[model samples]
Target chain A: MLNRPASDTQITHARRLWLYAVAVLVMAFLILPTFVVIPMSFSDSRFLRFPPQGFSLRWYESYLTSPEWMQATWVSLKVAVLTTLLATPLGIAASYGLHVSRVPFSRVLTIALISPLIIPIIILGVGIFYLYVRLGVVNTIPGLVMAHTILAIPFVVVTVSSGLQQYDSNQELAARNLGASRWTAFRTITLPQIRGSIVAGGLFAFITSFDEVVIALFISGGQNTTLTRRMFTGLRDEIDPTIAAISSLLIVLSVIMLLILVLSNRQK
Target chain B: MSKLSVRSQPIAIRDVTKTYGSFNALENVTLDIAAGEFLTLLGPSGSGKTTLLMVLAGFTRATSGHVLVGSQDMTRVPPHKRDFGMVFQNYALFPHMNVFGNVAYPLRLRRVSRSEIDTRVARALDLVQLSHLAERPIDALSGGQRQRIALARAIVFEPRVLLMDEPLSALDKNLREQMQIEIRNLHENLGITTVYVTHDQREALTMSDQVVVIDAGRISQKGAPREIYERPANAFVADFIGESTLLPVQAGADGFAFGGRALRATVAPPGGLFLVARPEKMELHRTDMDPAYNLFEGTLHQLVYQGETVLAQVALPEGQTISMRLTSRREVMAALPEPGKPITLALHPEDTVIVPERGQ
Candidate 1:
């Protein structure tokens, strides 16, 4: 390409510019909805449509004042926290077992652990809804947390396992030979080395549970409705401009949390 | 140095063997390491030196036989319970800890008080001369500094036994040599019973009071460095320990004849013998003046110049080669022997070691 004459340089530059412009257009196509919703949310119009004549913060104030929204937000946050606590340990155990087992069927075990991610979320939600109802735990915080943990565990395993791969096994053996018990060696040496992976996995798990909607739709009764479930209700039944406002707020919150997670990982 | 408080354990491995499936990682290897002695398990790669060290450290269990640390049977003991200090090949410094924290780790595990921990860690750092860098994070230090920290950490607890598995292998050549001397000095000062493992023959000879040469999952020979180098038991030891030129000789009752000349030697000459001649012991001359010695006429095949010595590879009259060393290339020029010209190579009677041929 560099061998081309100066006369053809203009043609080559034009071609590259055309390609970049096309890429920009494609990115705008994908991000257009997210950008359109922010302004539509602030519109004073009652309908959930763009190009409003007036702008106001009435919907934001309504969302802030409503007990239902506040309760659902609190429920989502609690479920995310609980799901992270459960899934991170369980995923670390599963990944460790897979890595250190040296068993013939260890690959099969790993695949089984990650199978939830392979399945469609709707199918899992339907099955879990029936299971929760039979177990008499539907619409309860524990039931929601359990379902979310099941969904979040695979991400945790992948992240933590990748982190463990960077660690040196000899360091642990060195600790053990230096008079540390196996558990103590793991606690002091192995855990600190992979702390970043655990944090990253926990962040993924928390984000997974916070935004989960299909399972919440089935299991969350009015008393235990999560923020996602309420947004779904507003979308389906009312098509309220409030739903757009909630979605815009959720997008902002997710961006902030994800930014923090990414920045923390970079620091590590 | 003060006497070590912990009683030195006599490490004994009796008929110990470890097998990973069909591969015999270690066979019925047995030896006793005296307390407070610097013993090295020396061998090339896959020769079971590291495996034996692991067995002694209790990181690995023998498939059969018992490992005794003094009177206590250590076969079933776990690694942590063995309380052995180990320096690994990579130096294994905790990346999360500073130099002080790293040295303090063993004491922390022992539940020593905070003030005692501080004092002991300071002393250990001082032992390696890294006291000023105690607060610096381990990753910030150079390779040699980190290794010194590893050594300090290993001996901070004053454990009864220290195990080092090629701990200096990762450093540059000059740095490795320097560390070898430093570690030897530390061992002499502390008198901690130590087992060091390395494949580098020079390292084994330099640091070990007694060297155990291993091959094919067994101990081939064991003795002091001078003894092992001077009188290697077999062809393996002679070749492995240093550069040796083995010449085929037809033996008579009094002496061995090579290239139609009866060579003078002190060692008994069997019917057929292999003479192990070290390069430095062989002399080269243009004239056959040393006819009384074991002199063989040869052509100069090659000349190699090391910084301190010049090695001359001579092609003998019997279609064989012998290497002789000189202090300078000027010596070779003084002899006035061309590369293709013929000359005589002579070995002193005491320099030629004779061994009977087996499994010929």
Candidate 2:
């Protein structure tokens, strides 16, 4: 009974019938088109259409077998995973330090760390492209990973910072009081409690890097090109049916990440 | 569980002061806690009691002071090295850990053998009478159960010093009272030197071998519960520890006089400005009362019939009202005079207490 949400029970379902209608309409308006690609990707038609000519595995087979598409997928995965690894720890450290820091301007430092999310991505893309050129790292794996990490960090920092906020830091103090060192207290007490937030933050970083196109367009090219960049180039050059299959796959990946985030939170 | 034992050590806090800019959270406070003694720092909120506890726990650094545990000066020691066990106000049990895990945390930190950890953890859980719930999640327990679990965890490591900051405040009144006796008993068995902090005077009285009453940033008074209650050092302690009326008195060549009437007491004046009268000690005077009892004439103002006791409020000639407490027995209620009637109240010399106007 306590876990039940305190919803507007005063308004009966019949009385608020229009609200459900409007909610369905709003969700359908925003989400309905993204789902259309699923069925179209299965179509054996020459052109992408809502009503497919007939269902077949040709486009999916094309995506799975094509070496370029497979390479782009591999690149996206590598970059996303690497970005998750690099950004999670840095973001968690910044947030933890900021949480316990009595030093001045920690708030300003947090804002600076999370500024990438607030800054216009196109502008950041141009700026990174210029910096990468000067550093002689454009079109390289390191350049792609570095750029993607920069874009992914803000999401990690924001999520993990929020996680740190909800956690009661006194547990760490209690651990210290019970003979655990400061670092041990954090690892044994503080870390396990906020594991959900850290995982969620990592997921956010992974998704941000995986779907990022603006920065990849500017600095990523050749062998290091991300799947998003490849998809963009393919769409620009003649819309391939394989793009539909890949879009369906991207949508599934995003859904899986969202599910993971929701499931982790539920465990907490 | 019965075999669980704790080592005891005396704590000496000398001239400890904690200052944040111009505000003094603790002001030159010094206290010595005897080995295995249950001492309570009792005060109102923001009275620096918890701050003093923190200083002892090494969580808060004193601006200048020395904390000697046994003979070692541990003033510069960090909390982790201090080896003190503390139960936080909210218990601070790891949400990710089960009951056994929560209680086993401190032992695990010391890298106790896995088999020994299981035995000791189970014993601690048995001590708290929650061994059956060893695998239960923290949030699954009730408030009172969590309080017991917190106690079990704090004492499981057998630290020489155990600090508790309002651990029972979250429990309901009945549970709080039950836990108070339970903790006092546990302290007797374990013999760990304990320092507890609470704003509740009754809890302090029921649990502590010594009580330090803090107000503002200083110790107002420290004594045994009966001594503090029976002979409060000043008006503050007199009023804070129990129900009392502080009737302003001026010191004269003879003795302290309350509004030109001499107040007689078996206990001498504490060299203060108020004659503290406890309502429960004052009775409705009968014609055959002791001749040496102090007498006051007043008009009955109101009679409050509480479930357990009856309070008869009286308005003195000078307009200072003092209540007289009476048991709510059938005969006692029948013998009471109605409001607006004149009455005489008596106080035995031993029941009278005089204190200074301010705690100073």
Give me the displacement of residue A18 in model 2, in angstroms.
Answer: 4.8
For candidate 2, the per-residue lDDT at A55 reads 88
Candidate 2 regions with alpha-carbon error over 4 angstroms: A1-22, A39-67, A101-110, B266-271, B286-290, B329-338
**lDDT by residue for model 2 over A1-268, one digit each (tens)?**
4334358555566666788999999999999899889989999887777778898989999999999999999999999999899989988898899999888999899889989989999999999999999999998878888888888788878888888899999899888998888999999888887889899999999999999999999988898888999999998987678889999999998999999989989987
Tens-digit lDDT track of model 1 for B1-360: 233244566688899899999999888888988988999999889999999999988888889999887788889989998878999999888998888888999999999999988888888888788889989998899999988999998898888789999998889999999999999998887888899999999999999999998987888889999877876666677778899877888866667777677877766435446777788877874354555567768889888878778888888778778888888866464774778888777777766677664211
**What's the residue-level lDDT of B138 in candidate 1?**
86
- What Cα-based lDDT does every candidate model obtain? 0.85, 0.89
> Candidate 1 lDDT, tens digit per residue, A33-61?
78889998898988888775489888888
Rate residue B312 of model 2 by lDDT. Answer: 92
- What's the TM-score of every candidate structure? 0.89, 0.91
Looking at model 2, residue B220 earns an lDDT score of 89
